[model samples]
Target: MPRSAREPGRATVQVTNHRLARLPDVQSQEVAPRTTPGSGPVVDVEQAEAALVEHYPRLVRLAYLVLPPGLGRTRRVLTAHALVQRALPRRRASASVIPAQAAGGTDGGGEDPGYSLLRLQVLRTALEAGRPPKRTAWPRRSQLPPLFPQVWGLKLFPRSGGAEELALDQQLSALSGPARAAYVLRGLERLPEDHVRKVLSAAGVTRPTAALREASRVPRQDALLESPEFDPCSLQARPTDLMRRRQHTKAALAAAGAAVVCGVLLAVPSGGWGPDGAAAPGYAQNPAARAALDPAKVTKVPPTAWRTSARTDFSVWPARGGLTGDTALLRRALAVWSRPGGSVQVSATPGTPSGAPAGPPQLLYAGRVDAARVVIFYDGLRLARYAEPARGTDGAALDFARVDAATGAEAEAVVLGRADGNVRYLTAPWVTKAAERDLLEPSAEAVDLGLQDGVTAPLAGPAEATGSCSSWNVLQLTEGSGIRLLTDLGELTPAHLTVGRPGAPGEASEPEALRTWSPFACSLAAVRSQGVRSVNAWEFARQTLPDGSGSAAWVCTRADTWRGDGPRVLAQFQTPGGRYGAVAAKAEGVTACGTKDPHVLAGVLWKSAEGRWYLLAAGSSDTGSIRATGGVTGSADGNLLAVRAAQGAQAGLKGTLEDGRTISGLR
Candidate 1:
């Protein structure tokens, strides 16, 4: 019979025999059709499997060329091997109908036998030959498959298109799992979207909506730039594609630059001088000075002046020595010698122990001596002296001097035995005629020393002398001395002569007396004595009397003194009511302690009459004890004290000069 009239199964055998005779002896395998009838024409499963195996190595080589350099060939081969294995099952299932489907005409109806089984075999063979194993052994240098055009382009033009290659890799990375697989299959591999979705579903990436949103939002530019393997110029693209890529790059760079600038600005200081410039508060102004002060041995504060008395007194000397006692004559002299435009006005208030109001300040004394000197003394020891050689008599200027009795030496006594016995010699430069007149006449209240508590009451007589001697209302006597003052009324002694009530016997109502005393009686010559109507009477005092013959003396005195022409009294003292004579003995060793005015004593040198030096600290409270040398140091809230002993010196013991060393302990 003719081939067309043969059995349906035999027809497929005839075609295969004819094709095998014409073709070369290529290795091939035959596969039996599955029993599931009406599915499609039977196909050779063994042949499809053999074809996939043969082409996998070449596919892996192609994938390796498109991938990053760091992913070794071995890894690429493994990936391709896995992909081929996965594809095999699908290919085998479809192989039965693949050849028949290709050969069948469109006009064939569903019910008709579509194509001969032998025709399906021929089609399958052609497809296998086209994708031979060797085709993927090396990367294709020609047009790349649509799946990874950008990556292929970069390989073709490395330097110019590398950025585009990177961008494509970035795009893939940015896509959600479902979208990434869909894109790889549809856009990259030219698979239909529906087929790509199927592949994604099989891979378990089912969320299609969320994947689409993420893919649209996150830009690929940042990822591309960060990736070392990506190159833009090497990527093959149309003009529009290149422009889009450039815009994305520019936006990313701008953002990065702004972030860097903001970071830098935030790192700088907000206010005041920066590094390498002027320092903050308490730092020295000069660079060299600051460096030296880094390990500073001394720090000095500026001097602060305080008016520390109520009825300030100053001593005045006669410009010529023998001036008339007439008030008018003294006034005329004062007017001529007064500061060019300055006038002297004085007033008096009630004396201590009696609240009697005194007359106003007067032009007691004022006058110019030589061209450079002008002196004014109001009250008694409260003095204001001005010496300015460069300034003319009428020039507007101020040259003030304060006489600190605590620090100043008394004028040497004149010998009354050989000269006039009743006449006292005027020593130092005497106050000018103007100064005397300006001081004596009463005017308005001239100064207010802002005294706290009560006025100082006068004490009478003399006894033992110890502890500190001051002119304020309060006295800080030693323990024994304080007890004596409270018990014995007649033991206290005024430093100067007494001036009683106006109507009392032998009473002239003289000005108040001001004096300084030595608690240890080391020397009586250094103590200051004077007379004035008003006194501050509230000054603070500190005393460091000798503990023994060899011990040092120290004292805390006012830091500043009054500046006036007359004998200026810097400090004063008075005894309490019903008390007489000095309380303590005139021993060689004694010490006293007390607090001082916070403002005036802020910055002064404190030297004890016994010869010890101390710096008067500001705002220190009165405490009456010495820091023990052999024990720990101590301090009050406002002040600190340090003690040091001589080398190998025991507590309360004295050491020789050469063998002595200091052990400083601070409070």
Candidate 2:
């Protein structure tokens, strides 16, 4: 149903320039249209319908962002689509009071009066969806979940984004509905503050000014507003509970049989089956309590599907290994994963949920590796590895690691088994060659590890190495065009290693890249078993020794995990003649040295050759100035800082970026 409106060409009021700049696609016409306090261009039913069709995706995304997150992702997606679809005018002619802004607006440059009306409608409904029901009033149609546009036996939601996007989502979740709308209009729509206030007011926000003030508290990460994490239209789908579906099917059949028997009894003479007063109470089985033990329902991908697939992520990997057809083995693995015994050793990477599979997960591998039977399953988000001895299910082990949105390089290989001092790997089918390289010696040549049916030959695993860490071994896989280096991190999946700066990282196969990794090869130990997706080492700065000894390198190594949270950053100092680099400073769960925030500051106490102690500090090349406070006080104009100090001296380091942002040193 649409709202009734006056005929077209009735209003004659000019909108201010501030409001005019909000629409990106608005064209410069011969005559500027006029608008009143709540009136814009005339929008007929046909015009509004056309606008909605053209910008359906954008409208849905806006609704998804403004809707309250407590509705859950599946419901939020469905509600967003429903709201946008219902945004059309019901009558033949309706005047759109919302005026189109300028071409430089935030929505990637598009403008239409009908689109503005649709946006206002969608925003108002989305805000209404988040409000709690009142006792004395009936819930609005927008407040109730739509009966249409429902998905059956499947769950759909947007793909996850980086930590910054996640943090922004959390921040928005804490704000009020109007505040969230204000933030989205400001960032996603790229509207001026006054324009945002007008739009919010037109969309039924009572306190638009207060909402604007509240949204200003969030950090300005406008680029992340367009991230796929918030786009409900570009979604990933996963099946619902298969076990429950089967049970429901059986129940339906039983109900049909009972109806047939009841009809026969009524035809004979007895009206119907006699009611039993002593019957026990009835209750449905809990889906969570039900075991996902059906081997037939296990998902399996074809062998050659990845060849023509557009995505190069873990979703494209085919089911490999010999025991994939073994229903008994697959059932046991699934059963154990859902409910492991006391003896089963269970470990999950940080931030990874160790819950039971939502439905039948895709089988990546199911076979015997060394003395144990290993089964790997990918359920859209995380990877679950189930391992037990060949003879029995005793002492089974289950490990989980977040692998959402893993690219081809990141999903190149996974550790199959670790036996004695060696480890075996299950490589992707696209991999052409595999080699083992010692990261400690950059000049040493890589030894080829032969591949058999996509499985790599066993090599000495660094996770098994104890005592003094002298040599660090890493696996190099040549997949399609480029090469990738992954090292075992005491987990089923290895961490991909790269060189150079955060945004522009390259393979470590080059001589210069290898040399950059040599000194900090042992630093990988700090991020082991943390579900690290990749680690990058960048030489940010170099300084000449004040003692006239030699030059030293300042390196920043950052470890990014699959979970997109808890990234590890290390700032290291390597003297010219030293064999290994000494760790200057380190901090966990911070983005100091990551791609988003590449600048890093660190300091270390070093002893000169002449028996003098000096406090040496350095920052990334973007540093405009560095200052040491607290126990030690000094300042530097550039990135490097060297000051004479006592041996046990401590100090706080602060750096000012060239962009005028102050950053603190990692500790």
Candidate 3:
């Protein structure tokens, strides 16, 4: 078997930075105090506060420099200020044994023990802020986003600099939290490698040497650290989406005026307003809710708008259907969405909010599907469906799913109806063809489904499959550029499927891509109603069997959701001649096997055809080494490992990257 031919790339640095930003803040633990050989000078609260006040700007800049740059400039700035403001100790504490930074630097605060202590406190909390929050502990004050010192309606960021500064910022962003601290201390504080190591260790870095080594990769540009680009104290303010803010203000004023008028008319003095069919009683005082239910206020885009629109998403999708002009049906749909009655069946995809719309939603469809009157609505963040018996409002159903930021093929189609073991889709105006194909039979030809007014013909939906999992149906939509596969996930929207490596995934229409999906097609059932946006399959490694039986491929499939939080990851192994891939391991809501963090580790216990058992594990190509612990203990170079073991054996796996960092396997 061949080792992964893929070369190591710089993406790991960016990925590491992304993973560090989302890490939960260390809650329950304080920064280990950096003690000197002898008892250090004790600094009182007054002295600390005095140091903080006199050198507030420089201290904030230091904190900002030390903090992870992935936090975004605005958050980093606010966090820096908050950390510096809170650096004053609650009680007397021993000052840092390390001496003050070099002279001739603008950032240098006097050699006051108080200043030293404040610097340590700021450095400690900033580093802690980058760490993941512990599950068993409560969050420390510094770990949470700063509530005070927030500037409303404005985004503050340091002044922009030239290409040199930009390049430096990008390089710094690639470094880990401790590495960033080391670089900042060395460049900004004029601390030598030895003193920087001491400060980093005192600040709780487990491996200061590795951090310094990583920091050394960035070229020395200490003078650039003094530029305004890195200075949080000198900030430029910009209004946040001024046009959107104005529109919201206008909407608020209009709603208020309408509420007053409606209140006067509905103040019956005896009984409240008349019944709102299948909807919860409306509160006369809630103007936003009232306005959202108005049929006339519903946004309707022109039919030809998509042809000329720059943005390609639901926002550009024009309203269509026979009853688009029917106000009565539209009113019923809006009312039901706001507050479905007890008799109405309501369902929502995971992480999707079923609450009333904040404003008038855009109309996507309003007409009939089979024996039911159906309507679809989009409100920027979510897609909502309302359906009832064609005869009357009886047996109404409302369903919601998150669809934020959907674009291209992802927003290409949506489910319109499901009845009699078949599903129908309402595709975007851009779709030129629609078809259905069995995923289990990758080589099978696609059956074309007629499209009338962008509505796809009824086809067997995989979501409704039960009993034997013999056949899995997936919808195929084709536009000018290429084709895409979307499968019913028991939600109002279908999840798109792609094949390739992370970040650079392509359409799963090619023969190779189709074959890659055939084995694990049934695994799609695991992510039903998960608000899945898209799923990507990537083959990370190929390992030769230790007993010379054959080689096997290790592939990872990840289902990314619309809410962007919960992702389902599955590691599967397929022997050379096997028809289906076996699930080696799986996990949910993990950063591993994701676009941001493309690396994954998984292990499986396999019994050879000759009756010998083994423990096999694999990681991404960048993995330098793998070591199995627990039930079966073995170590191997590179990402692939095969160790003889008993049947059904259990083991824990950890991988060391080419860099010194170690990562645990996906459970």
Candidate 4:
């Protein structure tokens, strides 16, 4: 075959060796410069060849690291050497030109002779020989491993297929000389535009316009060359086919035998019942019985009731009854009832009946009396006596009379003295007989009155003077309105109380009754019973006065409790603004009838004012229930109650408050 003419205006180099000739025309041009001796500068062809050989191994190693491993090692080494040999003469010529320029600066020498052209040649050889390999067209499908089922999977070819691929090449051929070279350099060798320009410049291929035009004409091959660096061995090792086959087989088996398996299991007895324990009485025959015995149908059994308590002495009493006992005794008994730590003492004095004898031998009262006050004594120490009605024997002075106990007679006599020597009597003139009658005897009735000055007086009567007295005064006042009493004692008391008239002195007082009293309030709403699985709603009302303005009316209901785990009592009070204030309580010392110290979950409090609701308090009770279980769980708001249902199992109850707030786990 006649050799094709080298492209016009493109650099060409003739090669002497048959091996070199058989290679591409570009390769021949690359290698020809090194072989041509003395054409431009005396070239040491042997030295260039030796240098290429010497650096070949390192070039191959570099290529291996950067290029795909599919390129065989031997081919890489050979290609490196060939490339180096081709590049040597071009670099040497450029290096020699530097000295030539310097010599020309001095005297315009015809050619630079001092430069070691051979050394330059060797360096250039090394560089060209180490250059990366040019990209090739898509390899044959047979060359690919079976693991790469898709030919385009390697991404080494344009996705446009063969027809479009030919069209792209034709477009490149119509470009000008420099453009064609630029296109060829960039497309074939995959060099960047700047790098191609640099390489061509170094090789004395200086035609800027042509190179740029050629670069512009080159079709973008990045789309074709961007292949996944896949390893054939890795793909071959995957179990894709096996996995698909197994999945298909599993699906087929399931579809084929599903009805048969279900039918067989359904027909067989579950072995769950009967007198002899051979089979269930109704097993598969009765639908309900079957369902009950079905293993897969099992579900959690929620707790029927929750009971809990703490070690508190306070007890809220129901509203129906009045307390019985010595008032003082009752107060003392109940005072320390809710206190965790307390003590009590009683003592009596042994003394003379009348008064203590003024002597050294007198004994003191028995027992300790610290922090105690004397409340009562049985003896009297003062007396009062009245004048007798009788005339005296002397005429001038009306006789002062005295009554004699023995005769029961009124006799005229001189008044010896008044009892305690403090009595004084005066006679008044009577204008009429009716006045004398009135003067003779004053009315024996006494008015029951309170001191308007706010000074308190001691009350009479044994109960008032002696036992069961509260620390605070318990007043029973009978006035025009009705009989009413005020005391600082409670249990099941009202949640809120209001007093004072509007626009009056110290008017309008609304105090939270439960908190102000000794014993806290308790409510029956949502009260849990043993083995009951439902929650109940109870409602109650409390009367209250409006604020200081006194123009509005207030009515309150039982809100909710603050404790999450314990029994919670809640009451709601309505304000003039149509909003409600709620109060809640967690009775610490309460439990179910049979159980001891069952954990009572805390309750959450919610208050609504002016249509907006807010959480106020979180109440809690310590029920000793979790002691048996290993773990403990609690909520942030203190309302969610947690308990171990069984070994390693937990259960919780939640309660809802107003405004979408909720308290849980009352058990």
Where is model 3 poorest over a 10-residue stretch in terms of lDDT? Answer: 10-19
Ordered list by TM-score, greatest first: 3, 2, 1, 4
Local accuracy by lDDT, each model: 0.25, 0.77, 0.80, 0.25
Off by over 4 Å in 4: 1-239, 242-547, 551-568, 583-667
lDDT of 1 by residue, 163-219 (tens): 675556556555444454334333323334444344344334556445544544544
lDDT of 3 by residue, 1-667 (tens): 0000111220000001101111111111011112233656878778788888888887898899888877888988999999998888976688878876755655577577888888888999999988878999998877788987799799999999999999999998888999999999999888889988988888889999999999999999989999999899899999899889999999999999999999777655343453366776554347787788889899999989999888889999999999999988888889888778898999898889998899999999998889988899999999999998988787889999888888998899988999877999999998999999998788999999989998988999773222225678999998988889998888888888999889899888888999998877877877877888899989888888766767777889999988888899988776655555666667788977777878888766655556566777888999999997766789999998888865434467789988878988765
Residue 26, model 4: lDDT of 19
lDDT by residue (tens digit), candidate 4, 34-59: 21222334334444444445443333
Better of 3 and 4 by lDDT: 3
Question: TM-score for all predictions?
Answer: 0.17, 0.56, 0.59, 0.15
Q: Identify the superior model by TM-score, candidate 1 or candidate 3.
A: 3
User: Which stretches of model 2 miss by more than 4 angstroms?
Assistant: 1-292, 463-467
Index of the highest-lDDT prediction: 3
Tens digits of per-residue lDDT, candidate 2, 86-150, equal: 98987533344445554576453266777888888999999999999899999999899887699
lDDT of 3: 0.80
Instruction: Tell me model 4's lDDT, rounded to 2 decimals.
Output: 0.25
Let me know the TM-score candidate 2 reaches against the reference structure. 0.56
Is 1 or 2 the stronger prediction by lDDT?
2
